[model samples]
Target: MKLLLILTALVAALAMPTSAMAAAFVVDDPVDGPGVGDPTDCDGGAPPGNCSLRDAIAAANASPEAANSITFQITALSLTAGPLLLTKPNTVIGQERNTTITWAAGAGPALTLEPTLTGTGSTLRRLVFVRTGGGAAGDPILRIQADGTFFDRGQLRNGPGDGAEVTSVAPATTDNVTFAGSTITGNARNGVRGATGARNLAITNTIFFGNGLKPISLEGAANAGAGAPVGLRVGPRQPDGSLPLSGTATTGGTIELYRGNPFSSASPTLGDSFGVGAGAFSRVPPFALAPGEPLATTLTTGGAGTSEFVLVSVPDDIVSPGLTSVRAINTTQLRMRLSEPIDPATVQAGNFSVEMASRPRAIRSVSVDGGGTEILITTAGGWLEGEAGYLQIGAPGSFADAAGNASLVAGRVRVAAGPGDFTPPRLSNVSVTPKKFCPSGVKRCRGPRGTKVTFTTNEEGRLELAAFKGRKQVGNRSFTKDKAGTYTIKFSGKLRAGRLSAGRYKLRFTMEDEVGNISPAATRTIRALGRKRR
Candidate 1:
């Protein structure tokens, strides 16, 4: 009977929605107590208003209501005293219609988080953190020690040195801590700093208007360990720092692009662009940009800003070069699928080829799916049918910038088909056409004569060519394929004849497959026939 009763309770617990298990807690009371020494405000005696933020944190830690709550709202509380420390898991929302934390001539920080106490759940929202004190050593304003989750929203500004900040002798031991929807400006040092194990830390939608150092700085660990996987994610504020109207994915989630407006919403258009370094950018899927789908976010100009968007999405059919997919068939062969189909005439080894825009040299052969819309491109020559492959697809403009404009917005991919008997070879055939300077076959023609050199392939894709003029470089071109899966490339902008001395120019064209497979150099000998001078 006891076992039966336990099973009944377990079933009941599973029936409850996750929301019922996790709920947000808000602190709006303004009762003020004594200034530390006074017995009246010693324990919980002080009125809510007089009670310092530290005292409130202690009270929340001891409160049974704080555990299951998602957020702790701290309305208008002053930090006139020293630093306010936290060592638990809870969000403190400040900056409501009333109240704030002030810094009148204090030598310490407005908020300080030490190493010993881990802030499992702690946040400072809607509060004004000021540093009116003088001197270079004027409190860091906000010092976050090792370990814990801290969500510091609201406004963090006007400190002698760095504004509301996170400091540690070594990197902290905390894992999931973040700074969002806050304005950190006019400080001496960097606005944010992450060391040793501040793994998975994020600073989003917060403005670093001005600072002596960069707005954000991260020194990742050199090696990897259980608690030491390293990376830092940052982005400007969204329109408003609140939940989206349509119930979008909340901030602080996996998928970086989903966290910010993919369309560069805050700084939308061509001029307002943000650039990520090769290190950070490399960590993301090469084709991170989504074209058509609501990839662009609308910025809210008024109060605070919030960024809430989805990153990984349902597979959709969108036609754009950027929308690409990859299917890895073991280590021998791979296949790539596209949103739209391409012509079979464009698939090949050297002449014209299609390859992954991210790592162009990573693929071997290209073939359009029997239907055209699907492409069967491979990297491993040994792949066979029935084998599975990895797929990575992106939207238009997601592939090449030279094609100029992009068409699709979002893209999707799945391991559709693999090596089975259907697996195809990486190369079909290679061909090259040489342009004759004197089409008339005349030994000599006009001066400064021009010629057209074209390379055509059955597969539709991109090609990289190296042209040599008798071992000397004539020029090189990276060609993009058209919809028909054919790359009809022309190398122009050259004066192969005229005033130049008469001589035989040996031009060699070497074609290569996406998988770094190269075709023997197809050599073409051209005699720069000269004409009599007037």
Candidate 2:
């Protein structure tokens, strides 16, 4: 009886269907071959056979086993057709230092993990994805819809869209996606985008640069739905759950911490310390995570950060120095009033210059005034009276403020030549030659053989002499003096031949200074006797 029972039990055990064994697919071909004919086949050697990446993915998806793996041994491969869709829980790993996946332009994502599938132990590691073309506006190099997916040590670059886009669909599942030790750069949009229904996303030890918008963007549906919280811990997370604090750092310009979503009406709540030079490991302001709402953090300029913190250098507040007033202290010196104090060391002769229609004036020196808000510019020569001139100060990067912020643009001031030589010249020693002579007992005095007038001035200027007979005819002489102090001018010959007919005559003298200042005219009257029957 015992032998018969053992025989029946053994038969029953053999009748039961056994679980299918998990299989490993090795992709040896680097070409875009056709899809697989038998999804259960993995031993086919190379291209046109079953060992290509596309066929491997298709075989893994079609396999009846719950767990499977796909690995590559090629140095490089191109995905010429559509994206390799992942419909099953599978681990795709690239050979260390030897595997690269390049997607053609306008093609779909390089890899898309379908939302309909559940990936509890799925992992993607040690791979490089170069998106050459064809990713549309909202497309990404990697699209994830699976739960508990892990991406490690990957490089995604040069894509027309985001590096990765993660979304969770209806069944309201919580997709806990973790990405670590990766680099995403030169993408058209965000480095990583968390679309609506995404949840429990974590990023660590990832470097992002040259992204068109934010490095990380969190978006949700427009309606209010219960979505899983998104937490971003930049750097390594400590065991105590608190971020390690570090010293402050500076940036080239203003660094924005968070941005508002253009698609939704909700605004981002940025912390007070969201500007440039924010410390690494600084606590970012908490914002609402609503459905259809979007939030992002942008890194527009270069900054400093550590492995565990987002340390950004503070940008100096640079304001162009404003010119309030420009005055000429003398012909060659100008005093410029500024809106604020400037750095003394930045003031140099090369930084300040004068320009006119003639040419650029040479800057002899530049100095700061006692008030600290004024700049003194001394030219090689005095300014010409009434000439239009421009005083330019602060060349780009040459001049800075007291806080070390450089002036990005040059500052200019328009000025005119100041009033000059207000004082009029003094004239003296006025005398007329060819004195009238009267013969003793003669009835009328006669004009001398010639008439000469002379004068002296204290300033170097043009001198004029006029000789008039009664209110009618006469002669005039003009001359110029090269130096200040004294000058003389004489006029002779015709008081106009017989024109000075034994009568009274008037002599007028005037002088004009170099700066166009005219002195009062000096006049002298004298009687001339008629020439005796010459």
Which has the greatest lDDT? Answer: 2
The stretch of ten residues in a row with the least summed lDDT in candidate 1 is: 236-245
lDDT of each: 0.42, 0.59
RMSD of 1: 19.1
Error of 1 at 427 (Å): 57
| Cα lDDT tens digits for candidate 1, 1-534 | 999999999999999765334333344343433354232332434444344455555554444343433222454544444555544455454533434555664446665655544235555655666555532564566766644445555666667666644445443354555676666666666566555544545555565545565455555541112121123222111112111112122222222233233323232221121322222222222233332323222121111122222223211222233335555544444555443334455444342232222233345676654233345555534434444433433433333111122334333344434433332222233343443443333444663344555554443344544344343333444555443233444443233332323556655444434433333345556655555565
- The CA lDDT at 226 in model 1 is 14
Count of backbone clashes, every candidate in sequence: 78, 22
Error of 1 at 166 (Å): 3.4
Question: Model 1 clash tally?
Answer: 78
RMSD of each: 19.1, 26.0
